[model samples]
Target: MNTFAHIKPIAQYNKVSYYSVCIEGNEISLFEEFITHHTSTNKKKLNHVLDWIKLIGNKYGAQSHLFRPEGETADASALPPKGIERKPHYTEYGKKKANNIRLYCLRANENVVFLFNGDIKTAHYAQDCPNVRKHFKLANKLTKAIDSAFANKDIVWNDDCTEIDCEDDFKLQF
Candidate 1:
């Protein structure tokens, strides 16, 4: 399986720290790449996303709507853009928008979230859209890889769950 080579600290606030997923040989993270691409191509939408992140970090900490389940039910019927089912291992974080954007993250713990990837919602149902489906598939793959890394001790969290320490050679196997 592919493992992540590094867990780069991306942001920290209110004693909560956020991280980016980096694979071996990649200087920039998947999250950074997403930001860069969206910033240049879709500045307005990207601004909304960044603002949402800032609000989550500065105001809510771990209790923000961004980190919460998209729906109250397992099938996420509470929200229409349903793609992946909400589980403890992985969940979708998104800000409601006319042009919806969703970020997938792995729940490392109560206090830590690792951003894997995201997508732009163009339809009422995510499964009906090709890009949304592709994004969810990627999220699922990353979720498995992360779970394996956790099982193997490649990813370890500090005592207070304030930091994550990963293996230097860790890279996503998929």
Candidate 2:
């Protein structure tokens, strides 16, 4: 079993510093992969998605959005939020429409988040999009892996929740 830990600070905004994680054998972190792949593929749309992430990290901290209603995407009270229902240990972060690139992450702690993967959604629900569906399935599997890591003491957090002590080769199995 492998573990997860904060590797290094990737970005900082408004006093909040975002860290990156690397599963053993991978040179780039999951966050780096998302930015690189998504930006290269669709700069205009994914830019907004990335900006939203930065804004959230700056204004209310990395975990602020998690405090909102689990399924609520915006302030609209009449219409339901687009996208599929998120599962335990996973949260979707991104805007709608062209900005509908959703990044699924695991809340390792109050201020620590481990981004697993993302998908571009083109429907009212993620299940309607093959790509989004695949990412969602991957997120579920990663969630289970994280759970098992915790159970086996493969993942451990520092007292302040600002850091983690993880074993090598922490990559997701499937």
Candidate 3:
């Protein structure tokens, strides 16, 4: 009861972040930052991206719990240990196509998170550097949104346990 009361707002906020990301590389540090909250905000576009993040993160509880990145793309953090499926999707970049690109989710703490891509088709063209950034950024938002929603509901987010899965993770499992 206490947990759901605490996290209800987080879910509302995360629902927004999930929609905030449309362009590539705009939302990466979001999901990861929620848990570690250590992203550096080093990118020139930090203001808009960070604003979106904080607005959503605040719904959970506090921002300090999240892992802040020194730079948006400084390093690639593997998805959280809570097992979820990675569904391969395609994106196109210039002349390159990133194939079987996984559009998937991660359970970061209590967050109900996942990634998105523009590669609805012709994935081979999705290999451009821009595509990578876009993917990472969108992935960030999905992650943050997930984090915000699940706030104190980690068990619910993970079906590998008895708690019934919530929102989208139950469907995302591959």
Score every model by TM-score.
0.70, 0.63, 0.27
lDDT values, one for every candidate: 0.57, 0.53, 0.32
Question: Looking at model 2, which ten-residue stretch has the lowest summed lDDT?
Answer: 74-83
Q: On residues 1-174, what C-alpha lDDT tens digit does candidate 1 reach at each position?
A: 444446677887764577766767787876787777677666665665566455555665554344535323212111112223321112225533343566656556546667655666666555665655665556566667667777888787788876778767566565
Predicted candidate 3 versus true structure: per-residue lDDT over 1-174, tens digit per residue: 111111121232432222222223233333333323223322322232334344534454222223223134432122211112211112234332223222223334333333233221223232344434465454544555445545655425334321234543222110
Candidate order (lDDT): 1, 2, 3
Q: Write the per-residue lDDT of candidate 2 for residues 1-174, one digit (tens) a residue.
A: 544433544665563445555555666876687778887786765665565556555665555434222133321110012333421111325432323667666555545555645666677665567766655555555656666666777767667656565655454343
TM-score of 2: 0.63
The TM-score of candidate 1 is 0.70
Rank list by TM-score = 1, 2, 3
Which runs of model 3 end up more than 4 angstroms from their true locations?
1-115, 118-128, 152-164, 167-174
Off by over 4 Å in 2: 1-26, 64-98, 169-174
Q: Specify the highest-TM-score model's number.
A: 1
Worst 10 residues of 3 by lDDT: 1-10
Assess the local accuracy of residue 17 in candidate 1 as a C-alpha lDDT between 0 and 100. 72
